[model samples]
Target: MTQATAPCCDANPDPRTLRGCCIGLSVATCLLFSGATTAADSFWSTIQLHGFAAQSVIKTSDNRFFGDSPDTSFDSTEIGVNASVRLDPKVLVAGQVLARRAGDMYDGTPSLDYALTDIALIASPERILGIRLGRVKNPLGLYNETRDVPFTRPGIFLPQVIYYDKVRNIVLSSDGAAVYGSLYNDLGEFSVTLVGGWPVLDDNVQWTYLGGDFPGTLRPNGSVWTGSLWYATVTEQLRFGLSGALASLRYAPHQNDILGPGQTDIVYGIASLQYSARRFTLSAEYGLEPVRWRRYGPLLPRQKVTSEGYYLQGTYRIRSNLELMACYEEGVADSDDRDGSEFAGVTGGLVPAHAMFSKIATVGLRWDPTPNLMLRAQYQWNQGTLVLSQLENPDFPRQREYWTLLALQVAFRF
Candidate 1:
């Protein structure tokens, strides 16, 4: 997905830090190339800068309410910046920043929270390998990297079922590196990459409630390594692609609430397929994570959480500037317990841990009134299962859960 096809953005059009960084690099790269600036550096002898902004309004409804009301509201605004400099004809560098509101994401916080979003470099495609680093976004699935941009995506909201981790875990980056290349083969053009690294940002940690004492804190502490292989080719008016990965996440011992000193073994796999033509494009993906969470705490439960998810979607370009899109997703998680009840409803009444499921369906339209502007509107239906504590529950502690939401966003690119 590309940001150009999404919706809603205005005000705070760019972040000052990223702007300064890229501009600084442009000047440095120019000085390194020659003693001074060159004519080739410009769109006419300089740097090119541009960006987009967006705002979203979300409404929610719960079928069965345990607390609060049956309806709620949230708003999110985002600012994106893209700057590029031509060090020379054969060498160039580029950077991007994405800052969005805290809105519905962080319940305890207000006033949009921001961070260093994405940083990458483009090189000659013919090289044996291309590399990129620095708080790099993880491209685990087909649309994870480009879904935020309207021009690259069919709809405003990507399948939340798949992007759930990315939305909440903003530290979705690798502090390592990746080497990639394209090879010509009989099957098609093969894109191969070998990547590995650790979490780039370690400023945030998640917490879970037990009672007066806070335990069961899920800390993002670890190092990950993975490799990928993909293939895509063009035939007539149609194009198709497929990708796969084998990765490992090892968490070193760290002390916390529920988890005193622990680690989690993660083996995740991903696959995707896509086909396209002038009128429409279709794509789908499936992902699985086999996890074994271990801890050395009397209150923490030794468990293995298996997570799996998939989605199917399509977009049809009705005309030169208008398009319609839709998608459906199903996600599931199964946790296995060794004891009778690791957690129960009451005090000392071993709590029973069970399996959980989630599903979502979304449909929307994107209006490209002009090449640089997009308008989007979408409706989503979601449902999930939850467990509440006996008395002063565990967190929100509701046995079962369900929700209906209406989301609208507008996106633009320059």
Candidate 2:
């Protein structure tokens, strides 16, 4: 049956925000009492609990970006539980909860910010249409849809080269709703979507000393809107798809907050191409952003920031249990506000020029000894360039950073 009428299954693993976890309790309750209701007659109303858990161990010679220490950091583990229930034949409800190492999450920061990521309801009355409300992915890019699960991704992490909007986990997911649908013909299926929402900000930002010892983030709240469109085709031997996305956010400065725009806007544009052959998958993307600012308080600068980036990744099936993967990416950021750039500014200086660029080469092996388990090992060499030396402090290393890691993941569905 098509997804629209297939009797809503458990929530897929995407909703991992703050309140998303509440949905999990719903699943646990149903699971504890659902055994008595199973029959073909109401089979569609069954409940399912889904989850994604992962742990990555890296032998870091230096915490390059995380200045806590320039030496070896501790091994980290991140786990999340997502429980979903098919409330009705046409509706699905889900909740998620996550636990990451104190020094990790969204960024290399130390935060026990164990809060809900997303809590929402989804309905797909037809294969051509789907709607979700509550905390949902803003639907801005290809990666955002699949980012919550590492095993479903092409890389250990979505290339930071182009995914740096993650600096402050900017506009990751929002408290809102979205509608998506597709038009199908004998030839292909074309899809479209429109999504908008607001983000709940937590006190997790680190502010630089502002003379009198007051430090905090500006624009405590930012308005956000994210949307996208795509088309897909599947032939006997070849499958292809085309997609694009947009993200826009506005932040108004706060009183006494030094590192925020008087009023700021962020926009992202992206296009991707994908092709699959007998045992190979190839994907490439190009993205651009034009950041604009206005009404800066005297504490800030007046300026416009624009940047662009691209990445290409390919996976080759070497054996039934192995694959070869590699990708190359680079981005250029230019800002009118020198010192405070990236999330809240202050990472660099105010000059309209290439702010920074990152280059990385990774080769890895994937072994799926069991259907629900995997073992992966990879070696990566990362190099970054910053227009100023100060920008190269921890993250943008003036020199090359090298690391080799072995990671193991095991998961199951009940």
Best by lDDT: 1
Report the lDDT of model 2 for residue 362: 68
Task: Please give, for residues 155-232, the per-residue lDDT of candidate 1 as tens digits.
Answer: 666665555522233224444555667655455566666555554221112211112222233234455655566666
lDDT of 2 at 165: 24
Error of 2 at 313 (Å): 0.5
Q: What is the lDDT of residue 132 in candidate 1?
A: 46
* Superposed model 1: Cα runs more than 4 Å off: 1-46, 63-74, 104-128, 165-171, 185-187, 201-222, 235-258, 335-355, 385-400
Q: Superposing every Cα of model 2 onto the true structure, what RMSD results?
A: 9.9
TM-score each candidate.
0.71, 0.71
CA RMSD of each candidate after superposition:
8.3, 9.9
